[model samples]
Target: MSEKEIYQRVEEWLSRMTLEQKIGQMIQTERMSITPEEVKVFHIGSVLSGGGSSPGENKPADWVKMNDAFWAASVEEDEKHLPIPILYGVDAIHGHNNVLGATIFPHNIGLGCANDPELVKKIAQSTAREILATGVEWTFAPTLAVARNNQWGRTYESYSEDPEIVKSYAGAFVEGLQGDLKTDSVIACVKHWVGDGGTTYGIDQGDTDISEAELRKIHIPPYIPAIQAGTLTVMASFNSWKGDKLHGHKYLLTDVLKEELGFKGFIISDWDGCDYLNADFHQTVAQGVNAGIDLFMVSEKWKPFGESLNQHVNSGNVKPERIDDAVRRILYVKIKYGLFEKPRPSARYWSNHESFGGSAHREVAREAVRKSLVLLKNENDLLPLKRDARIIVAGKNANDRGHQCGGFTVAWQGVSDSMDEESDEPASKITTAYGADAGVQRGKIIGGTSIWEGIKAMSPKAELNINGNMADRSRHDVGIVVIGETPYAEGMGDIRQGDETIAEMATKIKGLMKVLHPYGHSLVLNELHPEDLEAIKNITNQRIPAVVVLLSGRTLIIEKELEESTAFVAAWLPGSEGQGVADLLFGVYDFKGKLSFSWQKKAGENFRKGDEPYNPLFAFGYGLSYSNNTEN
Candidate 1:
């Protein structure tokens, strides 16, 4: 529909909605919190599947069935209600990652290293298709964080620290995700608006203590292109700017984003984001609404939030015009995307499509993995190993799919096959704390080939010895040691000084003492997985030409590991398609990824492209290929 037509419809719907209904339109609840009947009775506007919240069995058909029920509930006509379709959103960050069998793509950090906007767009396209197959209409993806510090746990979510790279990729990602809004598309949400990656000491949801000029230069540039490309939604950041929480920052949320940038779509609060604004629930609701958040992702607290919002509006705290404006924006997007006219979830064109995680999608993911593998060190040209060479694959990450995918995979913090055996306790009984196991069935978490499996598929002579046991080194021609950070997200992945025990630190790094920052914090990688270095040493010490493939979310302190390897490749969280790593090792593909972030030489050293004293192990944009030895 045209702009005039959409506006007319929005106004018409806005006129018909009651105050309670309008407030309902502004609230989004988690699927597990409310029943389908509650969705209809409460007139809820949106529903989402939080990271691990899935339907029975979590298959494509199961998702469709679940979505169909909710869709039916929302549109069921009644005397006091007007039917409005509810938008279903999920965190399909890297492919439809939350669902089983979806083709998981490399995390944004790896995509940034690939430095191909077209390839990123293709990945977005494939991601949208897979999400549609599962009956979800919206995906909270294309995280536009200009991550300055690698110590931040979510550095992998950022495309690049350089605004130019993020700016170049933003429009392409939006275009690919939205896709004309006619067919095979999902609503794109360009997220965590403004400076989520510039937090102090790389703390997630911490303060960004930068000047407005610096914030615009380093962070806000990416959102301009995303807005220009017509992203239908923007998620407010959980972090604060200059000690002010963004959820209640009226100037940035209203004056800058909606008025100045001309963002026509609705602005959404992150999960329970308003709760961070004030101690009182009513005050939080008032502040958030007045600050111009169009929708609130209240999760389980939707009912209480809705009731509180109603009281606030009735008491003249939240203006009725503001409520109308929020409703207008919501209706405008719903109508513009044809969500009102679209068929039920099970009847949609791509619903339960056979190509969900099929060969074609996996091929695109493989290409991304191949393009994203950065050849950090090719000492003596040890890479491009012969396919028939006898190989010994070692390291914990070598055979683990969960570690390869990293965080935000099947679960919120991601899962590992090597994680402790499933507890008999129900998933509900498990705590959602930082390091707590959420009772994930590791065996059924993901569907993909491990690095060892991929290598073995190409070369039958490959042997799997995860402990790096070289009982007979003479039989092996080469060793492939895959190592790096395990699965973690947000605060759980932060680099801190006191996290490791003294004995644990010593055992991980034999003679080297833990490198502490001037402030007594440590950003060392050895403490996280010291076994990685041990495996590398075990192979290299035996005089085997070892190739170290590091699978991590961001750059880590790897000087010791690099010193012991013949060749090193930064395979930054390559998802699902392990064969892509094998493709490069076996000479089927060449290394193309460059350093999206500068490689840190030591623990606790934070440096960017233009920072002073910018000595790094390898400079930004550095990579090597078989044909070209020169760095870009």
Candidate 2:
């Protein structure tokens, strides 16, 4: 349909919708909280599968069946109301990562290091296809956060700290995910609008204390390209600008994004994002609506939120014109995406089991993993190891698929093979009727090759000693130690203040003790995961040439680890395709990735492209390759 036709349809739908229906169109609920019948009765406009929230077997077919139920409910004709298709969204940020067997691509941090916009676009296209296979039409992805501080937990989600790199990748990603807004594509949401990564002390959802000029220069540039690429939605950030929360920031949400920049699509709130705006629910609804949020991702609170929004509108706290505008935007996007004309979720053009974790998608993911491995240290040219060399793979991350994928894989905070006895993190709690055991069946649970598996694939004689212990050390030619941060997301991954004790940090994170470092609150690579350093030391002490492959979300204090290793590779969260890491190690592929973020020498040190007294362990854009014969 043409632009005029889309607008005419949007206006026609806006004119007919009741106040409740319009409010429903503005609300997005989590699937677990509201039933399919509830979605129809309440006229809920959107539904989402929050991180690990899945239906009956958590398979592609299961997702299609579940979405089909919701689709049927939404379009079911009744005497009282008109039928409107509900939009189903997911955090398919990496590669439809929430589902098992789906090809998990390199996280955004790794992709940033690859520095290939075409590759990122291909990954986005594969991600969209996989998401469509599961019957989801929208994805909350291509996180445009320009992370300034490495201490932020979600640094891995950002493409780059440099806004120019982020700006370059944004349009390509949007274009890939939303190809002409057709049946095979999914709606792309460029996210956490403005300065989510520039928070104070690198705190997740903390205040971004910067001048508006600095904000535009560093943070807002990425969104311009994304908007230009015709992204259909923008998720509001959880963080505040200076002291003002973004959910209620009328100037940025309305005046800047919608009016000045000309974002035609809807603006959405993050998970319970409005609740952070005000103490009173009604006030939050009013403030959020007046601030120009087109949709509320209320999660479980959709009904109460809808009721509150209705009351706020009736009491004149929120203008009817604002409500109509919000509804119109929602309807416009729905129509533009061909949601109104499409059949049920199962009958969609791209929905099928073959596309979920297909070979072609996994191959793209493997190429991404190969391109993303940033070789930091190649002293004496220890990498490009012979395939026949006797290898000893050791460390916590060496054999763990969950740790390799990191956070936002299968679960909200991601899954881990090793769970602390005292901690009740998401990894321990998640079960999909696939299995009850967490550690033993974790590989099958998330479905990915560990670095150990990749090594064995190439060299079948390679021994897997996870703890780095060997009775006969002389048997191994080399020891490959894979180590880094375990699975964590948001506040759970934040490098706490130096003054804050582990006990205090644990209390703040609601007793999630697994994430707390026993030593101190710091970004030291060893301190956070001491066993990693121990494993590396165990191998190095035996005079074995230790090849340390660090799988982390961001640059860490790695001076101690670097000192103990012969060759060090900063493999930033290579997801599902550990063979790619092996490819670099075994000479099948050379290292191509450069440092997306500056490698910090000290813990909690803040350094960027233009910082004064700019001393880093390794500068930004640093990498080593066998072809160049470079050493760092």
Candidate 3:
């Protein structure tokens, strides 16, 4: 519809909504905290499932039923007179990541290495289809974070350190997700608004202590294309810009984003975002509304939030016009997406469809994994292993799908299917976590293939051993040690933030570096499990060639390990689809990925493109093809 038509519908809807209903439109609650009945009584505007939050069944049909309940309540109309369908959103960042059987794609960092904007758009389109199948309407994705610091926990969420790459691909992802704002597409939210990527010392939600000009130059450029692509919403950053929290930054949120950038859609607060404003709840609401946050993702605190917002509006502390403007934007987005026309979840085209985790989606994820694999080192042509060669896949990650998928799998931290219980055998020695024994068809594999299984499929006689002994290695022609960081999201993944001077911090870093020094680059000690170095040493000690398949969210200081090992490949958390890794390993596909982030030369040494003493182990865009370049 045209702007005039959309605005006219928005105005007509706004005219009928009561003050309480208008205020309700601004509050979003987590599904666990509020019910369908509460959604009707409170006239709650929207609902979200935080990471790890799902219905008891945790299936696509269950997700649809759960969302349908909230949708049913929001549009009931008996309580508040007029009905505005609730906008449901999820962190479908890499895929519809929350669903167990959904096809999991490479995270943004892996896609960044692919450097194909069109491919990235296709991935988003794939994600939208899976999300739509489950009846979800919005995705908090296409994270435009230009991660400058490798130490940042959320670095994997960024497309690149270069804003140019981020700028180039942001709109494609947005377009892919919100394709013409049709029923099959979910609204794309270009996220964490301004400078979440430029955080000081790579701390999560830390200050982006840069000048406005620098922020504009480095961080804000990506959003321009994303906005131009017709994204229906932009999520405010949890990080601060120039010492002011973005959730309440009036100039940036309202004047700059809305006025200067000409962003027509609504702005959303991060989860419990307004709580950071100040101790006074009333003042926080006033400032957030005045600063132009159309929707407050209060999660569980919507009750008090709604009450406070109403009091602020009635007392004239917050102008009703601000409320009207916020409501107008909310209704505008709802109408533009045709949510009013197709309010019920089950009525949507893809709703209750059995196509959630189809083979086609998995094939695309496999392709992403195949394209994103960076062959950092290949000595004596150790890769593309002879199909008949006896192989021993060692290390915890060799057969662990949960570790391969990383965080944001079935659970908040992720769950693993343990093919190798203690009673299973020597090959399955590594233990899996969480839902290892869930009665899913493939156990915890959940439409995923482990690297060990992928390897076995090609080389049926290959041996599987987590910590292979000398006898095992002596019998095998080649040993592939798949080892890297364990699953973690947000804060858990960050290496010591600059301010962490705690005794435990010092002890842990020292212990980690001590265990990791043998592998090379210990000073920039990553959160490497103790078994990683042991596995590599166990394999390399023998005469057999050792190929290290390193899985991580970002570069680790692995200069020594790379030298000691016959070959190394950097697989940045290739989600599910272990066949992709196996495909390249066994010569079914060639390596095509290049480095998206710069690899640090040594520990305690990290630099972006512009930094001085700019030595790196491997520069960005560095990679090796299977047919050529066999040197280190």
Best by lDDT: 1
C-alpha local distance difference test of each model:
0.85, 0.85, 0.80
Error of 1 at 130 (Å): 0.6
Off by over 4 Å in 3: 421-442, 470-474, 497-527, 630-632
Q: Name the runs in model 2 displaced over 4 angstroms.
A: 418-446, 471-473, 498-520
Q: Over the full model, what C-alpha lDDT does candidate 3 score relative to the true structure?
A: 0.80
lDDT of model number 2: 0.85
- Candidate 1 residue pairs in clash (backbone atoms < 3 Å): none
CA shift of 181, model 3, Å: 1.5
Ten residues in sequence with the least summed lDDT for candidate 2 = 510-519
Model 2 Cα shift for residue 353 (angstroms)? 3.3
lDDT of 1 by residue, 1-632 (tens): 78999999999989889998999899998888888999898889999988777888889999999999999999998887779999999999999988888899999999999999999999999999999999999999789999998777889998888999999999999999999997788999998997999977676676787999998888999999999999999999988788788888899999999999999999999888888775677789999999999999987889889999999999999999999999999998899999989999999999999989999999999999999999988877787898889899888888777788888887777877542223322121211322335564536445568788899999999988876876256898899999988777776676655644333433322122212222124556576677988898888778887899999888888878888988889999999999899999888988888988998888767779998979988899999999886685
Model 3 / residue 307 / CA error / Å: 0.7
TM-score of 1: 0.94
Q: Least accurate stretch of 10 residues (summed lDDT) in model 1?
A: 424-433
Give per-residue CA lDDT, model 2, range 267-307, as digits (tens): 99988888867567778889899998999998777888988
